[model samples]
Target: MTSGSEFPFSPDPVLSGTSDDRQHALQLNPQQLLDRIPVTIWQANDQGQIISLSARWQLITGRAPVDSLGEEFWNSVLLEDRDLSLQQWINACQQQRPFVLHLHLCSIRGNSCPFLIQSEPLLNDTDQLIGWVGTLQSTDVVIPLQSKWDYTQKFLQALLDNLSNGIVACDTQGVLTLFNSSAKKLHGLPLCPIPADEWASYYHLYQADGTTPLPQAEIPLYRALQGESVHNAEIVVKPSQGKPRTILASGDPIIAQDGQKLGAVVAIQDITLRKQAELELRKSEERWQLALQGTGDGLFDWNIVTNEVFMSPQLKQTLGYADHEVDNNFEGWRQLVHPDDLGEVAAAIEAHLRQSMPLYVAEYRMRCKDGSYKWNLARGQTKWDDNGQPIRMIGSHQDITRRKQAEMELARLNRDLEARVTSRTTQLEVAKNQKEALVVKEQEARRQSEVDRAGIKLYESIISNIQLGILVWHSQNLESVDHLELVSTNPAAESILKMNLHVEIGRQMSDIFPSFVGKHPDILLSLVEIIRTQQPRSIENVPYTFPEGDENLFSLRAFPLPEDCVGVAFENVTCKETNEPAFS
Candidate 1:
């Protein structure tokens, strides 16, 4: 028995045994040994004829070892590599050395198996090659490599065909190697005779700002070729005759398995819409500024969380503060508010925030730099977030100090005028009451005079006993003289004078009759005569008439009473003639 280590070559136990045993193993052949070795092995002669094959080769090729022995073996080789393989085998046989080959072997299952073959020339002692001994190893592990290669080719073709964005692949030298369908479509070119590095210059791509052509240094593809990965790099490209195009580009370095840089893959997408939107936003901001300038109201915006205030220039001017003097914060406003009005101002702001309504009016005193406080009418509205929390406030402030002062002055004037009117009304009311009292007193005094005059006439009638009328007069020159009451008398005056004789007896003449001069001219002359002579006088057959239209003949005698009142007694001459005619 020979151990494997004792043999220089691993010899088959059956082959090395005695002649009888060898003959027995030769009948079994290398085909049986190959199948037992778990690998398929075969040998072909110098003329590309199969000399022998293991059982696995027969099983894989679906042919017997004897059937594979001649030109039939060459026919069994895959047709694509058969001719080349045959030449290589002949060369190795001529050199009388070992050679290696990789070939696709067809299997009965219609699948192909890859194998590595190592062959050594079999030589006699005379140095002449007799046959070849080859060993075959199954290469099933290489199946994955072939599968990956097929999938990569399909994946790249699909990627280039279906991509929406422009894709270009270039070698490290900037020579265009691959251009996708989108890249062709973007430049309005066909895929035939795809453009190379000349495309870079022929397109004449410039930046959107019209500054310059896209420099290789700034291009994502160029950066990737320089061994850098670029992501979302923005670039603008302008053609020679059209509007500029904005693109967001990305690139990555393509490297071989051995870390050798091959080229770069670049992806570019149009971004013109995004840039246009940004430009519109800037214009909108400008319009907002213009609007604020047009309106006269002082505008302000305040952030609640930050407590910062943004005021337009007009707002600062309205507050009587220099632009720099007004601090851009709520604290500045709070400090400027009059101490007395601070609470009210705070309440108004809080109410607006809580109610989420516009505060149309709030009046407060704002201290100016000159140390004077002016009234300001502030109106504000709270801006709310989606959750109804107050986030910002916008408002206007108006200076109303002049108007407020005018209103206050008007109120004061009104109060003063009301007081004056009340005072004048009191004086007028007192004067009116006093005048009424004087008029009442005058009426009563006149009534008393009539009573006194009647009394005087009655006294004269009783004492004289002569159906006489008495007329009393006031002495004009004497301030203390009694005045007359009787304005006129007739024959019927005797009875009327008798009624008030007692009351008129010793009264002052002017006291008894205040209107004597206005009533009679004759009585006034009689009173003057009596007062001048200081004597009694009589008049006979004087005609007198009463206010009632009755006539009488009277003898008048006038005498002075106390206080210079005249007592005038008139006797009816008709009765006197009747009574004293016989005696005459």
Candidate 2:
């Protein structure tokens, strides 16, 4: 009957509310809670219009809420798979059930970021299907083609498409064929059938250094046509349409059973991030060399083939050794390191030599001349010969003892704060249990005791379990309190005054907490004013005086409780405290 009627669950919600539906309008403050959720949430109406979406969608996708609406949001899905994805959504809508699928969402950089979408239909009070809500989570799972035309082709294409590396094959004449999705993405070519050599100019193929333009014959595809098996041929593929990507390519000829020429195939692995890191290290080394006249860093170079090492004067100075005192070689540096860290440092260098890692980096304790250990960070870069053999290595060392000590200090402080929070959490739990117990005890006490006794018992129950110094104040007919009497006080509140709750209660606010009186004192009046405004207010790190003449720091908050009563919570804080407590 309608566009999405084929699926009863995917309903276009008619945005209308009844006069009798006032409860739905005031149901909850959804945004205050929803924004805190980790997942990317979205809501779409039955008519396929986006009603609402989470702020995180903009943060992750870089697409503003106003710009990404309805089908436009899904339009970024790979064109070949969009129709199938649409049908899947329709099925989920018809069933009115949750749907989960692995798909790619286009990012701001115009690259596909694979993610998992889990969505469910949203309904109203009368079981009316209104819309849908869903979350997007980044997933590593590759969404394979669901509809394979034939068993063999479907299986073959799905296998190729899901691979992390690009795969491309060509006929002996170099006619392009067997180009998988990864290959297409890496090359940034159109989906239309075409030959790589013909499109090579348009793709802007570059040499490994990312500056020299590669000739058509020198490109990986053409080199493969020459029957050459290339390995680790670093080619920077700078597509005119997409971001530049550096790929390590390997290709071998496809030989027939009869040894006849049968085109070739190449596997391309994107190593852009790795290449960028290496480039950065090289640049940093140059900067370090130029600044050697000013910085405190030490420099060293090692010729791997000759086993010869050269150290700068600063290098020896760093270890408190006179220049030229320490000999060159592994032994020169090894003896200066902590015995336990020496083995790991040697292993790190050896691993780098094996090409198991891009660079050698380690932080370890080195023995200073004073016999104390100091933390030092070392980073090494290797130079490889044309034949792929390591020829030389050079790097730098920097003293990082202060940084290490600060890290340990921060960790200790975090542990202390966590312990304090844990203690406060236990107190809150006890208070909650006391409230539940009092509700039951008060019901039974109502029969035996007077109303005043029942009320006092309830007030005392709250005061006993609370960790914060809490002061309860009564309101007068002025919509404010002319009576400055302290109606109730927790043990904590009374302790702040160097007295007991029985002594503090029924006394004037000025007589109990000195900070609430005198010339600048609206601290109590502010609390009363905040209650009148129906809003909570807090002031931090203010001075409070006790009856014992002790001045301490306290952060205070006042909020309206049930009835016309206002409750003020006093949080004792130290000058060293940094975080401000939230008021609700």
Candidate 3:
């Protein structure tokens, strides 16, 4: 009972009138069965104080039942859950109905465990309320639920019963903990507890030959702990309690989510009878030859110590050879092996003999009886002595000409693909150069347009700045006079000369200048003199007549430029004439 609990049990359900009050008594041995029960059972007096508890309380709660008597049991409850458990208990009692809640039990060792607390009120024969019966079952309610772990445990148990192989498991500390029935039978007895390092000694396991002591590093269980899956590894176990047994063991590592090595599981199978049958079968050469025939393979056995080799009849038959046609020496094989495959095949065998490889396996060509070659895949396993030296070797050959031919075809296609890529790349380069040439042509044309624009601007500036009339003339003849031709003239030249030759830029000098019906010959004479002498000539007060019959006084001059071209400058200086003398 809680020391300060306030609620009372309701009397309605506690009476013997309802099905809730139905009760029956059965005989139970408290000392024999109750203590062994996996849950904690308790009884509380009518006053709601705990009177008794099962022994499991001590194991799970880490406390003696006596230490949790009466309301002190509420002290064992965690402080946060005590009041709620008390209230739940009182309410269930008052209502006379069973109640279930979860409680955290604090152990004497300062650890806590969760429990499913259930309670039902007990009554007397007089229909009077009695003490309460309650149970505390350890629960996961207070901690995170491990649904996956529970599933794994159930799955592992299921597999143990169904699998044929004897399985043994160990905890992380290397202590053997689980031994399935199969394991017990295969091992002849349960393995006594031993350190992980002493397993080989305690178990007495040997190599497949039954005499060589099995190395700890070669043990399946130890290799599993190192995170490997060892399969079909044969060994012999000669136990002190049983006859010698040969077994095949496979093992795997049980690792955690964080890659922690949790444990190892090893499966053992008894192969003693099977191994004996295999040995008996090996004695009949006819059966061996028949087996090789069924598999369509040829066999060869080599004795390294004696330098002797035995080739099966099927081997000679495969090469289209009759019995006794080929030599019985290893040199026969070397001569038949294709030259291209000789070095590689030799290297493969040497690598296995030197222990660099686990098995000797190679695909190569061997010359046939018809002088053609056939591809064959050869595989062998060696029997080694204690010092890892090969004593005997046995192998088989399988025809693989189709596979090798397919590989050659694939290589041919790869070469064709490379050729196509190279051709495509060259074509792209040629197109790229053509596009670059077009770009160069476009740039040159744009530069020419810029130069033309600059020349036009310069010409306009010189014409607008010069004040005197300027006429450009070129000689039309080389050895004659009066052959002056007008090539160009400015607006000043046309206006001052009163020629009004706005639309006559390329007219000849004879058409633009006043010639007075061929009487004004001085103008032509001056041009001829300038061209012949390549010098300047000036004429003052020159008489000039217009085509309208009006006379004008003008000062005229002609200057020679290079390339038989002349420039003329003339002005109407009638008002400014001061009788300056002119010379030509």
Q: What TM-score fits each model?
A: 0.34, 0.32, 0.29
- Candidate 2 residue-wise lDDT, 1-584, digit = tens: 11222222332222246854445445534453344456676777865455566667776678776566777777766665565455556545666766665556777777777677888777789988888777776664333542342477788999999998999886555555577889889988843334545646666778887889888777777788789988888888888787899998899888999998777888999999887887897876544443353334677888788877767678778778876787787667778889999889989988998899999999899887788988877888999987989988988776667656655555554565566665677665555565455555545444333453444345445444766787777665435444566776677876665666786677766666545477336576776776578677788777766666677787777776544567778877855446656333
Indicate which candidate wins on TM-score: 1
Tens digit of per-residue lDDT, candidate 1, span 1-584:
01111111334646666899778776764334445666655555545455666666666778675676666766657776575555555544655667776667676777766767788776678886666777776667545587776689799888777988988776544555566887665544432222233444565545556467666576677778788899998776665555667787789999999997767888988787789977996775444553453355566778897999877777677667787998889988788889999888888888888884466358999887788888877877887777988888877776666556655655564565566665687665655565455455545554554554455455445444534455645444543323434433334344743334345544544455444334555656656667666666665566555555666565666665444545566556655645332112
Inter-residue clash pairs, candidate 3 = 1-48, 1-49, 8-94, 9-93, 9-94, 10-94
For every candidate, C-alpha RMSD to the true structure in Å:
48.5, 34.6, 41.0
Which regions in candidate 2 have their CA more than 4 angstroms from the true location? 1-149, 191-197, 290-292, 295-311, 317-329, 335-584
**Each model's backbone clash number:** 22, 3, 6
Model 1: residue 489 alpha-carbon error in angstroms: 99
Error of model 2, residue 396, in angstroms: 10
In model 2, what lDDT does residue 69 have?
Answer: 70
Ranking by TM-score: 1, 2, 3
Lowest lDDT sum, 10 consecutive residues, model 1, at 1-10
